[model samples]
Target: MDGLLLQGFFRSSAAWRVRIALNLKGIGYAQVARHLRRGEQRAPDFMAKNPQGLVPALEVPGQGVLTQSLAIIEWLEETQPGAPLLPADPWARARVRSLAQIIACDIHPIQNLRVLAYLKRELGQEGPTVDAFARHWITGGLAALEQRLATEAETGLFCHGDAPGLADLCLVPQLGNARRFGTELSPYPTILRIEAACLALPAFQQSAPDRQPDAE
Candidate 1:
C-alpha cells in the first residue's frame, strides 16, 4: 500500500468512524475488507496486522498497523492537515472528546456486535432479548448526549461547532446502530438534527455503510 490501507468491514461502526475521518481529511486509501461475521479478521495475515482481530486497522505506509477506531481518529486529527477534527482550544477539545467518548466508550462497548453475539451464542439470549439489551444502553446514552447537545452552548450545526468534528464522527455511526436495534429516535432532536447536518456533507455521505464496496 503506497498510501493507506483501511482494513474493515462495511457495516462496522468503528470502521465507519475512521472512514469519515479519512474522508474529512481528504486522504486517499484502499479498503481491505475483513468480514467480522465470517471471522475474516481472525485470519493469520490480518492477525499479524492486528492481534485483537478487529476491523478498522489502518496500515500506514511505514508506521505499521494502527488499531482502535478512536485512537486512529485522534492520530489522524493530530497528523493530517485538511480539516481539524478537534478544536484548537484545549477546553473545547476536551468537551468534544467527552461527547465522543460517551458513544465510543460507553454506548458502543455495550451495543457492539461482539457483545451482541456473545449474548446470543454464549448466554443463549433470545433475539428480542439481545436486541432489547442493545437498545437499552444506546437509548440511555443518546438521552444523555441529547441533553448535553441540546443545552450546551458549544453545540452548533454539528456536535461541537458549525463544522463536523470528532464527536460528529462518533455520533453518526452510533445512530446507525441505534436504528439497527430499533431505538426510538424522535426524542433526540438535537442529535437527529446534527445527524442530518452531517449527512448533508460529502465526507459523511460517502463514508456511509451502504456506499462501501463490501456492503452486504
Candidate 2:
C-alpha cells in the first residue's frame, strides 16, 4: 500500500487501464513517467524492473514488481476489494472477462507500441501505412464489440449491467486510441454511448492521458 510506483507512459492504453483500476479502487500511487517514444523502457533501470521492456510495470513496496495490465488489475482487485472490478458471481465474472479480453487480448496487442515500431523500423512501412493498418484492425474489433453491446441485454450504463467494471475500463482507453487515429466511432453508437457514460465518472476522467503529469 505504501510507495506504490507506477512505471508507465501517458498515452499507453495498457497503462491507462491500470490507472483507471487504481483510481476506481481509490489506491494512491506515485507515477514515474516512461517515455515510450524515446525508447526509455529499454533503459537499464526499467529493464531491471521489467525485462520485457514494457510500460506499466508496477512496483509495490513489499511485493516486488508486477507486469501485464490484466494481471495487475486482478491483483489490485484481490488486494483492495473495496470497489470490486469484476462481478461477484462466477458466470457474470466470466462474461466480464470475455468482454474485457475482446479489447485487451484481440485489439490492443495488435496495435501496441512495439508492434507499430516494428512495422516502421523492420518492415520499412511508412507512418501512414502503419497507422492505416492499426485503424483497420481497431475498427473491425470495435464494430464487433458495438454489435454485441447493442444486442446484449446485460449491457446497460456500462459494458456490464450498469456498473463501471473491467470491460468498461478496457473499452474507454481503446476508444481513446481509436479517436486519436481518427477512426470514426459514429458507427459504434453503443460503444460511444457506453464511453460517454464511463467518462461521466471521476475515475475514468482523472485517468485520461490528457490529465496525466507527463501529458503534452
Candidate 3:
C-alpha cells in the first residue's frame, strides 16, 4: 500500500467531507494538522502542496497531491471503485451531484471560515450579526433542500437512495455547521431525517469535526 496523507483542519466542513469519503473507502491515511485559525494554511510549506491554502489537501504516494474536497472525493471514487460514492445510473448520479452542490456550492462557501472572517474583519460585523448571517443563508439553503427532498421521489433513506452516497457526504457537514451557528433545524424534517441516517453510520460519525485529533 502506498502512503497517503490528508492535510486539513479539524473544524472545516470541507475537510470533513473528504474525511468521510476516505473512511467510506476504507483507506488508511495519516493526518497532518493545518490550523486554519492561525493562518497556517497560508504558510509557504502548506501552500506549496495546495496553492489555494485550503484544508483537506490529499497527498497520495504515486499521485502526488490532490486539492478541493469534491474533486478529491471524485478521484477516490475513480481510483477506488469498490466502495462507490456515486450512483450507477447517469441520471441518478446527476441528481446526487445536484443535491451535493446545493450544500457545497450554495451553502458551505458563503458560511466558511474565510468568508466569516472577512465578514468580521473587513466588513466589521459583530458576533450576533455574523451569526445571523450564517443562520439566514443556512436556513435558506436547507429550506430549498427540504422542499426538494420532501417532494422528490429520489430521496430515500439517504439523499438519493437507501445507500449513502455523495450527497449524504455533503449534507451531513453542512448540518453540523447549521447546528454550530444556532440555525433552527426543526423546519426541515426531511433534511433532519437524512442527517440522522448519515450520522448513524460510523463513516460519518468518525469523520466529524469533534472526532478529529486536532479538534479544539
Q: All candidates' TM-scores?
A: 0.98, 0.97, 0.97
| lDDT by residue for model 2 (97-131), tens | 99899899999999887898899999999999998
Clashes of 3: 0
Clashes of 1: 0
Which 10-residue window of candidate 3 scores lowest in summed lDDT?
A: 75-84
List, residue by residue over 130-157, the lDDT tens digit for candidate 1.
9999999999999999999999999999
Cα deviation in Å at residue 19, candidate 3? Answer: 0.7
| lDDT tens digits, residue span 1-216, model 3 | 358899998988889999999888888888999998899999999989988898889999876899999999999998784568999899989989998999999999998888889999999999999989998889999999999999999889988889888999999989889989999899999989989998899989999998899998
The per-model lDDT (C-alpha) reads 0.94, 0.92, 0.90
Residue 110 CA displacement from its true place in model 3, Å: 0.6
Going through the candidates in the order shown, the clash numbers are: 0, 0, 0
Q: Which structure is stronger by TM-score: 1 or 3?
A: 1
Candidate 3 regions exceeding 4 Å error are none
* Segments in model 1 whose C-alpha atoms lie over 4 Å from true places: none
The global Cα lDDT (0 to 1) of model 2 is 0.92
Candidate closer to the true structure by TM-score (higher is better), 1 or 2: 1
True-vs-predicted CA distance for residue 123, candidate 1, Å: 1.0
